[model samples]
Target: MLASVAAGLASTALGGAASAEGGGVPALQLITLTGPGTSGGDTGPGELLARQDAVLAKVGNPTTTYRWTTALNGFAVELTPEQVAVVESDPEVASVEANSVRPMSARRTPVPSSAQVRQPRATGGAGVVIGLVDSGLAPESPLFAGVPGLGRGPKDFAGSCEVGEDWPATTCNRKVVASGWWVAGFGPERIRSSEHLSPRDAVGHGTQVASVAAGNAGVSVRMRGRTIGEFGGIAPQARIAPYKACWGAPDPRDDGCATADLVSAIDRATADGVDVLDLAVAGPPGTDTVERALLGAAEADIVVVAAAGNDGREEYAAHGSPWVTTVGASLGSVWQGRVSVVGGPTLTGASRSRRTSPPTRLVLGADAAAPGATRRHAAQCRPGSLDAAATAGRAVYCERGGIGRIDKSEAVALADGVAMVLGNVRPGPVVDDFHAVPTVQLSAPDAQRLTRWVRSHDRTSIRMSGVAPSPVAGRTAAWSPSGDPRSSVIKPDVVAVGDGVLGAVPDQRGWAMFGGTSAAAARVAGAAALLRSRHDWRAPVVRSVLATTAVPLGTESVLRQGGGRAGADVRGARLALVVRTPRYREVLESGSWGDLNQSSVLVRATGSVTRRVTNLGSRAEYFSAQAIGFTRHRVRVTPLAARLSPGETATFRITVTGPSTPGHVDDGWIRWRGARGSVTRVPVAITR
Candidate 1:
């Protein structure tokens, strides 16, 4: 009788507002509830739905599409503006945000090494679970097959597989412990026929990421019926749990992930007990609803790694929250194609093509223009711009830009061209994409020189061969964006080898080279899983350990390389964390980037900060501190030397006093050496 009376009161209160906005479609909003009745222990799903239904009765109670309770206490619902106002007025609501749809922002080795760099022993990440929150997976690929010695699945993991078309419950094996997909917020009408309805990856992004993070070891990557090399994941023994939140579209660039779906995936992964979360997708900065869920994930002891956007140095890195480790792309072991000018010096450039071509006549793209085609179009090798007669049996030079790199090769193939020489116009990183025909890619200066040589002589012939490994170690890729000056926390906390990383594709037995920070994040995520498997540490400690021990990659500023390349040299390395007192924590409690207890330091203004380090070694030792690489600023460290016993903790202070010049930045490292051979380094960035 009491329940009937409450329902009657709700109807009376909401009946008039049912059609308050009149006739337009309702907008979806994500509402995060707090206080009581948020967690599963506090409120049952049925009871919560009844409460929500009564509250939303004023606006014609729509079905709640998503209910996130683990990592985030939120629900997604379609409501009119008037209805949103009603929800906002409720005392349980913490935040109400419009469901925002964002575009999908789309690592070669098991350990961090190439032909030129020193190799570290691979740490098989046994008993670790890496949760990938991105596109679906290719369950049939051999990369996700069970290992030889692997026994039972992880005891702590409670994730399950969602059976769908081409995806059976049996697909989730010991290697892939969990598989699921959420596309409710992405809308069913937007899903294309080419995409899968299950966790099976129609788009290859998720598979590539999973392969780089935790695929089976010693898998042969055979392309075009030839074995390229034996490849494996950095943490080959770790288990994978993939949650597909992003969906494919007809236009590849139109591929996007709904924010509502992202939050739900994060929530589920947290509940599933994943040790590491690899997020390759990009989203807006600051404390939005999604970032809030990331904080919840961190609080749940999950180490989150995200991709620094591929927008290049002009834009700031995305997902710059201090809680998540943002990773940038860097070129490692490179495969170059050699183009020998019949009588001129041979030019070596980036290449992903496996085929080699003998000497053939080379023609400028503009010189082979079809009738009625614009010179610009012909130069860019746009489809239908090349004349078949002029381009037949010749190596066409197509300038980068205007169209897809593969599209240029397609146009060349359509013109009966035997080969292509693709070149960039401006200074930037050259991606080695697998093309339709044999091709060579050159930088701006080299391309300009080649163009001049081609036009100067009437008959220019060139021979293209070799796609062998030529290591370009350490330098950060130009396409990976720099850190934001506005944020207090330095972004791109580490760099990883992202260029020309070979990984699994959607097709069975297919492998391809991938680039961008997506690959870099996977590498770091794998490394984080390795750390978790080796030691019992908190998420923040794991992040600090990686950042502090990173080796410098090139001469770029900390804004570009942060703590240099992502490395795990924790052997005899001291753990340093920024000291944050209770007062400071309360003052900056909104997941403050500046207040994070990270080892790396980023001083936007002249200020003094304190750090604490604990000796995790077995014996007592004395340590000395020294500053390296600092210029244009006064960096002083107090207590330059300290003596501590095993398991002892010590505190130190670092003061930065410098000119308040705008846009001026300085970088260096705080190195500490212990008498017992212990060494630790912390990256520092100061900006004015």
Candidate 2:
């Protein structure tokens, strides 16, 4: 039976909200350029270059020229919004749009310490290199202090010389360097007072994300100890190489990363030989430049992990690739708070505030406008009832659906009367959103009672209170991306704690809470580092072991949950098998006689033997053999067939061959076709 952490508390039924308004200007459509076909006729660098030149000539230089690539065909150029009109007028232009940019938001939830039933032993991921392809890194930050074997200071992929030491203020030279290109979007422009060139993390999302995978918790105190905070991150010892890409400034002219810059970062990280790559960004669902870069990482043998997105909508595209592990969010006990709503006939002009109380044996149907009453989807609510419930100071109940909980909350707020909202119930416990309103999520049965009570009586009172403590095993969050529907190949092979996670921020004194598959991916990467440290396994071996060892989340055949939980044994098992195989063989001849047609001598073998197999990997392995000669000859062996667990037993086999003329006796050995250590070898014994 597979061991798994149960699903965390389900989120309360609330509306999903977009980022706070007025922070950054929304994305605008820009000019688009097309390239030559990438089919057999136009396949080659020369064809691509010619296509690029043609596209560039038509656009005519203005502010800047950004180059992007389609999954097929040649390069696509991204021009300024003004240039977009001009480019579209040209005969060769294909399409135009505002640069495809998305605002970064917190997604993955943090895991509560109470949920961590088993603390993984500290494995050395010190030697494994991780590349943070973000804005830039702060050399003086506590996260990077005293770290040894730092792989060179951050190189200017954007080609900016005036590198700042702090956030947001750091500037990238936009002269269109040989490799990197600057495009348009949102966020910071000028370098901040600090020394880091990366965008100022005023939003405090990216820094928190980086720290989750590589930063040592508690080492940086500014980032508080939310269950998602300091104690997070899988590989504390791994080194980080940051790449400045996104800018968090408000200037339309100075924010965001160009597609070219993103590609260059991928190349740089690959060239630097980073072991793990964490990309917390997302975009459109189709085959775009960003998706290709992720694919490139897979081809390069680097483990790429990305966020599954936190929009609460399932229609969004995931950061998907065969090599990339997408992560999701689950509720943690530390983040749970019980809310109570009290209303009675005697009560008048009573104004109540949201409070966090200890867990208690609270009874249902005690009050009308109870705290845990709202659902995630607006569609789940009774027709026209949500609006009525919101206005009359009554609690609202809704079923979970596609619409965001934030939107529902905003609607309730607008109603000006509803005390709170209750979400639909699920099998596991439910979680509340990061909203400030008095919202509570109840199980399906609880939601039904509240709905029935409001219908039965015009004046109804409700009171609810319960303290939800963290669980021993981390809840399996559902945000992680699963396998493609058509193909059962696991897309996201593992899960880790990502919601409400805490980590480093841009400024020295501030820390932020972050969540999403991005953080989970980083944690998995760190775990991979630990496996690498303990065993000599490559990327494939490590990937296989992790997948096979994952404890199943549940019987649910969902894709996002994947093979299940990730641990050291899962990460190291496959590599151990590779190490056990005999890669090289040496033959020795005993005697050389002149006239004798055949000679029989003793044969011996010598080589290094390593047996580091763990209990999780000690299974029976089978083997087979075959001998071929001048005229379809058959060979007999001492042990026809045998089974051996790794390191436990070694059986010897002798083959008597029926041969022909004097040339060379080749004893062939063939093992079962699909077995782990299956091999075919020829043992040469020459006769005088």
TM-score top scorer: 1
Each model's TM-score, in the order given? 0.77, 0.50
| Candidate 1 per-residue lDDT over residues 1-688, each given as its tens digit | 1222233234323433444554434666888765222322356556665655555565566556677666656677766677788788987677789887776545222222231111323347788899998888997777788756543356677788876778888998888888777776776457778897677888788898898888777676665455545677888889999898888877766677888788888888888889999988766666677876776677667888989878874678887777788898877875678888988768888775556677899999988899999999999999999999999989999999999887899899999998999999999766555566788889898898898888788799999986676757668888888887767778889988886666788975477666678988998998898888877766777877778777787678888888888855565566545332222223334545454556778887688877777665667788899888888789999889888786688888889887777878888888888887766777888887
Residue-level error in angstroms, candidate 1, position 627: 2.2
How many angstroms is residue 594 displaced in model 1 relative to the true structure, after the best TM-score fit?
4.2
Model 1 local distance difference test score: 0.76
Instruction: Name the best candidate (by lDDT).
Output: 1
After TM-score superposition, the amount by which residue 280's alpha carbon in candidate 1 deviates from its true location, in angstroms, is 1.2
Query: Where is model 1 poorest over a 10-residue stretch in terms of lDDT?
Result: 109-118
**Worst window of 10 by summed lDDT in candidate 2:** 1-10
lDDT of candidates 1 onward, in order: 0.76, 0.42
Instruction: Enumerate clash totals for all models, in the order shown.
Output: 1, 87
